[model samples]
Target: MKLVSLITAFSLISGLVEAGNERKFTTIQPDLTEIRKAQATAQPYEFKEEYVPGKVFDRFYNIWLENTDYDKAAGEPHMKDLRKKGITLTNYWAVTHPSQPNYLASVAGDYFGLDHDEFVRMPANVTTLANLLDAKGISWGEYQEHSPYPGFQGFNFSNQETYANDYVRKHNPLVLMDVITSDETQLSKIKNFTDFEHDLEAKKLPQWSFITPNMTNDGHDSTIKVAGTWSKNFLEPLLKNDYFTEKTLVVLTFDENETYEEPNRVLAILLGDIPEDLKGTEDDTFYDHYSLISTVQENWDLPKLGRNDCGANVFKIIADKTGYENIKVDMDGVYNNKSVEGWFSDKHIPLPPPHCCE
Candidate 1:
């Protein structure tokens, strides 16, 4: 009897070892120390050719050269590490310049086409992609991290309005909006990132969810290492989370590429619930903020609303046939033609508006 028990124990131990070996971990981590060190070495400011102006195609081609270099020399290894751990996106695009506009564009499908931070409520005439989702009876929520102060809690709330609303209202205006407006209780559904634990524990997940991590960690002005680390720490686990992996899609992208001229490249990462043809692939498709709006419209079958809509192309990052079965075309072949030297043409020109408030 003792010999038989010993044999069973040995078999269990061997199985554990094999299972451990089969699991792969991501290579990237939010390394604040490394990020700070790298930033220390960066020169105060320097120009690069990628910022120069030309045709859209030529401009992107030139920018790609340096971006390829920057990624290869700095962030490439981390990207590979992410891929090994199942975090990847074949084609992604930065939604806009500055930050807030991109965020608005993602949900609204029009940059609201605003030029300033004026907090006017989105016009009733403008149809938002979020509204479209609401109509379809698909559930959705915005998972804001460290909010409760910025008035992001509910839909239709803005950062500027948090003052009168107090902590919860200030932080999550979106929730408040739905509370007052949406009859389906969609506002109740919007939650803080921490709330993810409860949903996971209860085994409840909506068809669509939008998550936004806080300022410090999201790679806005922070060092790439810090951003990458935050991404790894939060995302690595979520990728493995059973609920997220099966039908969910995770999009990681910058609001804007910022002022960097060299590399002139920002990131767009998509993962989860992708079709076989679209999975584990990388696309050099030329795209911008409007592309995201276009994608959301296409996914929900919503109508396009602005000037960009007429010509905008949505690059399908996840082509899950079983779920989002929209046929995709090659976005690269679409006309990249521009009347002027592309948007970057103004890089060297004198600014119509000064750095200070005009």
Candidate 2:
């Protein structure tokens, strides 16, 4: 269900901090005050110009805004899947369009201001989520769905079936392999999702696990239904397992919104052993990929990675672990079906078809 609360006042500034030799800055914390001001200035549930076009897409945006229900959208069911065995990010989001940019954003927060995917070698100064986590002695892995090794080119990114497991990892081959392969523990963490099944069953997983499901299963290569099904099949089983829940956080998020017109659009859900006060309740707080990076760093008491260190904080999706009321429905108020009707029609918003679908 959707919960709407009017937010109020604050000073949302943007800039950098230079203390001694270290550079510091704030993440993209939503200006609740700004949101409240905008809400007060505009009518409730009205579509903002940024999220809608003239007439067609505006209708969709208006409908989505009015509905305001997070549960209405299609997503995985059965929290007992294999992959979601711990903390979940109900309001997680990726930074930009296309998988590469979002992936980089998730790891480095800001994509280094690159507009397109270019396989150039990243500089030593370019810090990643992995780097930050490592600096703090917290182990982490990218866990590309099909990769066997951990390095700059370990993540598979090909359309072919066989090549998927062995393709290069980044848009730019210029990435430093040392940064990727230096950590033995972190490198060992990278594995195929299928490889995690044995670990899940054996109750042998690392302290902090960061997984990147295959393109097809994580809403990148196939229908949303397919993605949901795969998520439920793999992640749900683990969340329901007691062995994985003691002190873990699980996050499943979309890399970016389906359309550019809906610029600040992405899906993130959190699940796991969070404080009782922050479980099960849905939060509408504005957030993005960088926020997640910040959250992780904050959780582990590590220094912030690159731009995301102070960009945004993940919205508190569930605040109490009492478990939700299990309210599943489509946008039309239909029970069972998860897909929203007319969510992306020509009548709803003005945007090109989804990149993968097209």
Q: What TM-score does model 1 achieve against the real structure?
A: 0.56
User: What are the clash counts of all predictions, listed in order?
Assistant: 20, 54
- Candidate 2: worst-modelled 10 consecutive residues by lDDT: 57-66
Off by over 4 Å in 1: 1-77, 85-91, 117-120, 149-186, 260-265, 275-279, 300-311, 317-358
Per-residue lDDT over 179-282 for candidate 1, one digit per residue giving the tens place of the 0 to 100 score:
22343344445555556565556555554555655544554334556666776777677767765566555555555444434323456655555456655566
lDDT agreement with native, every candidate? 0.42, 0.41
Model 2, 289: alpha-carbon shift in Å?
A: 0.7
Leading candidate by TM-score: 2
Best by lDDT: 1
